[model samples]
Target: SFDVGGKEAPKVQLTKDGKEVKFTSVEGTRHVYSIAEVKPEHQGVYKLTAKNKTSSEETTVTLNVTGMYIIQ
Candidate 1:
């Protein structure tokens, strides 16, 4: 999850391994991103970017999947 610290609402974008990916945004939330039902193929470097009229912010995270199966 990420937070936006600007006056205006920013456009959020999420990417995995340099490719654009889909994320879930719940209603009434500011800037929350979620990936449901994670799988082994989902392991990669994820980058999130939020840009508004005045400023922009971004972050990166790495997802590593190990073991037989993920419970949740």
Candidate 2:
């Protein structure tokens, strides 16, 4: 989620591994990105960019998929 204060809402873009990713929701100044199921291929870097007429800001996150375990 992100906050870009003011009347006009900023445009939010999310990318995963250099490819554009779909956003789940965008309410007010908040943006949400959701992946239904996480897989090995889904493990990578993610970037979020918030832009407006005036200024823009960005952030990056890295996700590592070491292993998955099921408890019986």
Using lDDT, give the best candidate's number: 2
lDDT of 2 by residue, 1-72 (tens): 555565556777899989999878877776777778887888999998877888888899999877778999
Clashes found in each candidate (C-alpha, N, C closer than 3 A): 0, 0
Q: What local lDDT score does residue 70 receive in model 2, on the 0 to 100 scale?
A: 92
lDDT of 1 by residue, 1-60 (tens): 665555787788889999988766635435565657777898999998888988888899
Please give the distance, in angstroms, between residue 28's alpha carbon in candidate 2 and its true position after superposition: 2.3
Clashing pairs in 1: none
Candidate 2 local Cα displacement, residue 14, angstroms:
0.3
Runs in model 2 deviating more than 4 A are 69-72
Which run of 10 residues does model 2 get worst, by summed lDDT?
A: 1-10
Of the candidates shown, which would achieve the greatest TM-score relative to the real structure?
2
Instruction: Give candidate 2's error at residue 59 in angstroms.
Output: 0.3
TM-score of 1: 0.72
